[model samples]
Target: MMTRAFRTAAVVGAGTIGLSWTALFAAHGLTVRVSDPRPDLDEAVTEALTRYAPHLAARGLDVTGLADRVRIAADVTEAVRDADVVQENGPERAEFKRELFATLTREAPAHALLLSSSSAIPSTAFTAQLPDEAAARVLIGHPFNPPHLLPLVEVVPGARTGEDAVRAAVDFYTSLDRTPVVERVEIPGFVGNRLQNALSREAVSLVQQGVVTPEDLDRIVTDSLGLRWATVGPFLGAHLGGGPGGYRHLVEHIGASMQSLTDGPAPDADAQERLIGAVEKAYGSAPYAELSETRDRRQLAVLDALSETTGTTTPKEEN
Candidate 1:
């Protein structure tokens, strides 16, 4: 089994995701070094932790009096100097990441696992800059926003990445009480992002064609598909589709329909205009602040309840 917690982790950037990453590490008793050139980086980190700490406490997390472990550094080299792992949350552009990783190779600790929080770009595009660098130790560790609440972290390894590095990452995230799904192949958008985009495209297209308003479309998914997805993934759901026979019946029948699916074109100008109009009509001009607040509370409540019944610590103790 991997260690319980990463000893030290450097978070290189203090954007929204970067700050949340910092909070997660600090709350978990990991020494976290946060690096960012932004003048307000420290302020941003403070604000993010302040906003999220309460929610974490409510979930039975161990953030009590542990916030001070977060250290703000002026640059990447200083941040990663003694760290066991480094999580880069820098600009999404490939060129920017290339330069960052190259600099990291020269400064970061020899065995520190370097990971990117990128949703789309793969490590292959950036690790090239560190030719002699341990490319195998560099991989993607994309987390859902508000990393504390949502536990899914997609782990994608580059072609040259070693198995040890990949497994280490999975172990590291799991230690943080997060779910880590590893992708053997480095496909574009990985899995979650692609699945989200596929659904989003259809949702947008529906609204653009006046088939349904945005609110109604969102409702349809949330009331139906999202509820199911929250419990089980699409493939597993399909596995249960044919009852005892599993997906065998699905493949024998609907398999042909799947093959006939097309790579449709992007939404056009008219479609966008219609979509915008539909949004206004369905949701009205009222601000969604109240709605968002309500949704957040409800989601967190459900998560807390689920955690109680299907949590890590209690089940292990019982077993």
Candidate 2:
């Protein structure tokens, strides 16, 4: 067996997020067992890994024989039996997660780290049914979109999650070269998604109000805030924006302007349909494959450029 901090992983779910986790795990030399009830499990994983191979290579990861290290388990129990880490990407509903996690904690090894890729819905909500010992190992390890590419994994512990689990979660994600930020309070949507949702609401409002087309709105953000945030993040960027004064100075000077900006209107069903239509009209013409490929290519370029500036690169594992 391969020796590492966390040698074997069980990825529970085979959707986009689950498959991405599988690719990253196998790329890092962990033996992976993936489970999903979907009939096309084998085909889906094969296609996703094949598509992700080049991007993983560009990120300086050795993906040779990657698929050979991953296996499709017979069931959820089988998937997690001896797992050192269990990453659950199951449905986001609280009820579904409650039942799923109960099974996971019962089956997975006692010392395994149980993580969820849930966008929201705190671990406490679902883990209420679990015993203290089982609940201690489970927490939200939410990743930003496309877990294979993005560098962040928000580590939000449940109310009952032990300190040991919290520290272990951080260490495990760090080993994979992921930036794991722990949220002291487990708020809805956690930090990244809350900020992203706030921005998304305004972006939708802008397109719906005809302030800009969907395509132009994307360009505007990618050229400005998106690029800026990628570099310094929001608060740091604002600190720099303050000239020599820092965030406090910037806020004092532009506080009025910032406060004057009205909150975006909450869209009704009709408005949502229109927003979707507008977005589809703008970029839906392109095939999903083309769009995804273009996105990965550009994102890889940005990551490479950042690596050059920082004099560091992503850690590559021997497979």
Candidate 3:
């Protein structure tokens, strides 16, 4: 029943996240005005759009004439003028964001939906200075890295945000074929990052303890947990792991062992060096740009296979 259309989107920031968002908006047929202080904004954005076009096409999105729809703006005010949705991907500094949001609240049209691409900073951190009415339209639309490919957009609303605005944000993302998961309660790092850090922490600990080399650790993940999690999440995997007995059976049998594992020591400074060295040796030799392109291509292929088998597209694909 939620029906909303975003015809023009303003992407504030010309960094990686912002550029990816610009490409995504253009692919979805929205007129995108990108603003950033960088002198090379036009060249950078154009290149990013070009890089992302094939990926978007592979995901079944229409990327025809995508570059023509994007325009580069000199400042935030110019970018957001007449924008239906303002996706801010500014610097993570709280003070800077507070000032930036205040400007957005003042200059942006009242009907405009102000969404931030902040990862850890909550909406309240910046919206605190805005008027109640303006604050109500602001919320977080945090996406994983490479927003053009990743479909998970965490829609976290501040305490003062309106329910209608949240619903509209969800509908807007859904229209773009994104899976927007609403965070009912605001928490640091939202949900995805928190879960990611939890696993990363353990991974680092294991390597620090000399239990596994970084390459071996990564291979284990890509082969086992990553493959399984790509299909079913941990909870569901646990449910299946219990056979016919279900989650209750899992807890009764392995809960104590799991608790013990959780008590493992955190990684220390030495572990950091070992992890860095191992990772550097494993993949640091290749140029990051090449590795990133390879990663995106492989991700697309995996998603294609997943879609064929599951009768549902991966988060990266249009639903």
Candidate 4:
């Protein structure tokens, strides 16, 4: 693996994801240059960092000099100048990303890893327009929402991407204390989002069928599947659920039942309406800011508990 240590990083985009990344980089003592077109970019980023600073501290990351290390760049080219890695969080349009990656390939340093935070689009979609040499350095380093707190970062490489570039990208994120999973294949949605959406589809179907209220459905997950998955992922959970016989026992006993559920009809238009109405009734009255704060606090508490049980510090402790 590449042992290159990055000192300065560039953030392309000052939106939510970009701002979160900027905060994390600065908190970890990397000089962060952020580029965005927003008129209130500086003010917005400062406010975001201020809000996240305490959370970072709670997770064992020092906030000292964090604000001093972050600067707003005048443009993309300027943002990436003298940087070791470029984390692009620009608009998620195919054409826009294609043009942006091409510009990044031309402007950024040849050795710097060109990483995109694109969720759906693969690296090939943007790197297709670049020459082989430049495209070899471009790939997707897609992070979960609220990346500063979440540990998962999917490192996916395009067909033309070099192994060294992929290794550098993975090492870069691993340095940031992220769980970097190198995807062997470049598929849409990677892995986490696909699993989340699959569960969501079934959850919506259950609610639409009036099998459970929206609140109850959420409660069921939190009390059972969610809690279980937090400790052991689905596959392992199934292996344990099968007792001493393991996964083979699970398949032999419930394979048909699982297959039947998988083959069930997907949610239709009426189901979508019902799901929407149920969700609206449950949370539509609350302000989004309040809900998000609640979510972050709960997530932090869970991480703390997990850390205590696992005898390992949270990712932020690496700082």
Query: Per-prediction TM-score, please?
Result: 0.79, 0.81, 0.82, 0.82
By summed lDDT, the worst window of 10 consecutive residues in model 2 runs over: 287-296
Residue 256 in model 1: shift from native, Å? Answer: 5.8
lDDT of 4 by residue, 60-158 (tens): 999998999999999999999888999999998989999988888888888888999999889897777688999999999999989999999999999
Per-residue lDDT over 107-190 for candidate 3, one digit per residue giving the tens place of the 0 to 100 score? 888899999999998999878878899999999999999988889999999999999899999999998899999998899899
- Top candidate on lDDT is 3
Give the clashing pairs for model 1.
Answer: none
**Candidate 2 structure lDDT:** 0.85
Q: Between candidates 1 and 3, name the one with more favorable TM-score.
A: 3
RMSD of each: 12.5, 12.6, 12.0, 12.0
Per-residue error for 169 in candidate 4, Å, reads: 1.0
Question: In model 1, which runs have C-alpha deviations exceeding 4 angstroms?
Answer: 1-5, 251-319
Ranking by TM-score: 3, 4, 2, 1
Q: Tell me the lDDT of model 4 at 197.
A: 89
Candidate 1 per-residue lDDT, tens place, 165-259, comes to 88889988988889999998888888989999998899899899999999999889876678667665665445444344445555546655775
For model 3 the TM-score comes to 0.82
* C-alpha lDDT score of every prediction, in listed order: 0.79, 0.85, 0.86, 0.84
Residue 206's lDDT within candidate 3 is: 94
Q: For residues 180-229, what per-residue lDDT tens digits would candidate 2 score against the true structure?
A: 99998989999988998999999999899999999999989876777666
